[model samples]
Target: MKPTEQIESTLDHVNMYSTPSDLKITDIRFTDIYGAPMHCSLMKIYTNSELVGFGEVRDAASKTYALMVKDRILGENPCNIDKIFRRIKQFGWHGRQSGGVCGIEVALWDIAGKAYGIPVYQMLGGKFRDKIRMYCDTDIDPHLSGVEAGQRVKQRLEKGYTLVKFDLGIGLLADVEGALCAPLGFLDQMKAYPPEVLFHSRATDEASRALRNKVYDLHNIAHPFTGIRITEKGLDYLEQYAAEVRSAVGYHVPLAIDHIGHIGVEDCIKLAQRLDKYTFAWLEDLVPWQYTDQYVHISRACQTPICTGEDIYLKENFLPLLQSRGVSVIHPDILTCGGILECKKIGDLAQDYEVAMAIHMAESPIACMAAVHTAAATENFLALEFHSEDVPWWSDLVCGLPHPIVQQGYIAVPDTPGLGIKALNDDVIAEHIHPGIPGQWEATEAWNNEWSHDRLWS
Candidate 1:
């Protein structure tokens, strides 16, 4: 068969009205892939044809759109990917229609991959490699001393993680109550030119210097790649901290940092330029993603890689950054960037600009495995971030894997089918969920509302 013909044949005939009359939409379930919620809808297409497919609505509100799409997909052939996406978008009038449709499209693809006996990556194009390099977070408890933090880094390296990220944001140690920005603190902090700089115990320059060295020393232990995450803090010390880190690690090791806690891109560029001596790996999130032009300016000003995108939710968010060549690396949080399929799309887009890709992760193994598969399939993937290195039982959450997920500083991608990791560890879920927060999303009617075509184009 010809390639185009094969592609067309791969999709079974799809019609909105054809149905065996036995199947019905049975259940809907969702998992947070990157802080945003994605869903899986199980449709019993026949008395015996129990075909389960997955879908997503980019965020919580998307569930409402999913509800709408479900009404349309009731008896239709689930094999028509393009038709389904077009219909969903057509009916979904609100702008950002792509998000909801893209998500459901993902689940459809998952179902299609399973139905056709192939991985989603194979259907997209083909796999590039078998394993992905990972950047593991060095987890630290509140108020941990430099010595204590160093121990955490050692443990991650010993476990075979090649790269590590540490948090240095002043907000981590700031006394919110006493902060001038208290109550509406983040806003006030943003207004302050040189934000207040404070550590867990308010360490002085000497103490901060000593502590920085202790943490830096861990870089050369078993593996040398290391990075740090600092909140937007006193700009005065930005250069000093960069110098301190460089002096401690020498020139061979790379030092990177993140600007969480609402810092502006201009300020981030200033800080990055100040820290030029250290040859920092990347200065992250100088400004929120909406400011693409600012990101471009920051990238131009600093030789250090300008990387952002963790907060970016999909391909559209990545295009502005890519088209401008704003950053050398594109960081997409697997959970936020529409899980595996969406993130890979972002990575592939970044690869076009010769930009490296890294992930921002904060979830469990379910999302990690999805990320691994996507990262495995892409050509320009740099590393996947593991944020649970400090959680003692983090690895025990998932079961029945062919090998340990992370090995010798990298994660071995699973060649198996359908996300390749089981989500059935009850004990692990119970142990990890925040005590006050409940698990299993409670259905909220708040998201449902009548839609008027404001954002949508005809």
Candidate 2:
């Protein structure tokens, strides 16, 4: 389609924003999914009309992620969203879709939006909200008391974040031994052990139930829309944990739960059914996207909203879910779901059904910025998750940005052209560089053992 042809699909596209300027990919950046901090790179895209756009590329921790990125986006037209993704997928065949191809595709759209001199949402369909409401996770230190968690909420409000969520299902079922048994370092261990062994080693019900109450107590004091991210252990004792939390906090605050890599849709439905009395924000990732029909059924049955798609790649991946109306909200991780442009499209589709959107974010500030921009443009955005609360150094990654994207718990839309945030490359390099992973600007040797057995498992 020509630049002026007015092409529109559920797919990612750059519609005219602020008079049509010829758009081209002028730059790229990337982020690493699994390691400390994050990794990213900037690339430049050029167009026949002499317009240039900047793009970003990122990946979760994988051996050949950087090489995989190069394989996909080196010469592709950053403006062509679908074509770029197709190219990335071809190179990403072996890896499936965790981060490599997905990250590069994201940066390309960021570049496209920048090239067009518009916020990504404007290209998607323009935005509905001036500021996107955000919910920060509640304070959870093995050391902190419920009062301390409540104090943190006061502090969070002072910092400007309006909403809060926390790990609610920690130690559940203290009466039952080994009730909560989440694998330690499941990210690294999952690479070594099969799923069954990992499950066997995880927490038991009693312990899981105990920890969950601790988290629930913290949730009890959290303000309304105080969200909860439940671990797999928590989900295991769904009936017990949900009942406890609802009773402890009362129904005034909205309850929410994330799958956290545990419990399929069946379990999600069961949990929702068990807690039907409380007003829930949503049931996140009841199952993976492949179980669309199951998700639909769960949504139909549960009083709680059904949400999924944190790891899904783009709008196309989410359309069937939306069309089925299985989910009440579409949860798109700005990094995983093809970045800002794709996320905006996902939100737009959700808007068609009057379904809301809640962004799933857990990366560094870079990904958060992309999310804020996209969320600013998305009308149906219910809330965006800021996963940086525990990490003090997260926001420093983008210290030079024009204004603080987040204030008083709401993120103001960036008025600048493109993604409207600059990468602190020098700081990024100083903090994130590791041996063989890409020295400075180049991809490094294959990463075989980046993760060691160090951090405690979940």
Candidate 3:
């Protein structure tokens, strides 16, 4: 073929199929992935070109977060991701409220990488490590026998996991009566709902059944609100629970603890003191991450390392915690921590304070892989979480990998373009869409229009 004909043929193909460069934010659609009970929706940005960028909303947040950003980036080039992020970043708020902006950011990076033909990490300044270490979020079965707990520990060690986390909350004492204080009316409110109720804790059947008999917002009810206190007997039983698990799992491995219910700093100090013998990797979210002083108190009071930050948004928000040395370790869920670049910034900020960082992940492989990229790029990263270790199909959600989704407790960062996924298998994804939502990737015509009085200052 002549050069002129070849050039014509290329131009014809560009018109025939939307070229990656001609892309604009033409459409966005979403659906939930049900395994973890997360509102796992995807934001797909359509361009004038053939390519589409995919991003996942953090779990348990509404799809509206992503939908609201549609008006801001509708005609913008996704390749200019930093500019696009700045335009929409103001809309993001603290915690889950920032889900939409964060989700859109992930999709933008996805689109930008696909357009430039590179990996997301390279966009953020290459990587620090070839593979990222991981900690499997395992729970000790309060109902399991001592032998069973030991077996579970052995299983993790055999599987090559160097780090593991477990719950050390009032939920463990749910089966033990007179442990968790509650209002009589609230206790009655809990009795009204059975284990199958929508408000139940999905973490465990034991926690569900145990907490079901407690007050309102069983696990989330704050200590200040409930005025719950552990009696001497209650404290004894709680320590016993910790001791049994520690005896089984042993102290050599890095054992982290979380979901400690909503107990305040004082009681948190006591609980951390009781379990200090076990040397937890960190005592996580003993109270919410918002209270900087409380974190400083908890950090000083407890011999065990203090940690939080799963719901924290952006690096700027994380500054107070790091600057104050509120906690010894920083944990940020990448989904809400300002996507890849912002999360890397959070880690870098923590590094200056000599604080280590960890990633909290609960979404599907899309978000996990995104976390993997950020984790690989950060130096102080301790471990990225694998929240759905029990679900075999979770890894099957995406394809085109050089290795298994995880190997020997580390995920090898792939050297592929655009999040390193060749293509997501649509048929496989359709099979696993959240059961509560009937529509799978349906057209998002309802959110096509936007409304706002969005502005910060003149």
User: How many steric clashes between backbone atoms does each model show?
Assistant: 10, 63, 5
> Positional deviation of 332 in candidate 3, in angstroms?
0.8
Q: Candidate 1, residue 243: CA error in Å?
A: 4.7
lDDT of 1 by residue, 1-458 (tens): 99999877755532112242333333344432221111221111211244455444433233444555455554455556556555555544322333445445555555555455556666657778777777776545535554555566556666776666665444443533332122344334333422112112224578766654554343222101112223344544444544544454455544457633444444455567766666766767666666788888888887888888876655776899899988898887654565466677788888888999987655555556657777778889888877655555556656656445566767766644445543344565454433223444344333234344434556
> Of the candidates shown, which would achieve the greatest TM-score relative to the real structure?
3
TM-score of each: 0.67, 0.66, 0.88
lDDT for model 3 comes to 0.76
What stretches of model 3 exceed 4 Å from their correct place? Answer: 1-22, 145-147, 185-220
lDDT of 3 by residue, 269-364 (tens): 888889898777998888777888888888888788888898888788888888888888899987788787889889999999999999999888
The C-alpha local distance difference test score for the whole of candidate 1 amounts to 0.55
lDDT of 1 at 340: 60
Candidate 1 TM-score, true structure as reference: 0.67
Higher-scoring candidate on lDDT, 1 or 3: 3
Per residue, candidate 2 scores C-alpha lDDT tens digits across 1-458 of: 66545443312333343224334333333323223233334333344444444433443334244344553344456668777665455343211244556555555656666555566667666667777788875535434444444455556656866556654333233223344433344323322433223212225578755654544443233211222234445445645545555555555655466533343445445567766665667666655666778877888887777777776766777888888988888877765676566677788888888888888775555566677777777777888887666555555555445444566777777766566555444564456554334444432323322433332446
Ranking by TM-score: 3, 1, 2
| Cα TM-score of candidate 2 | 0.66
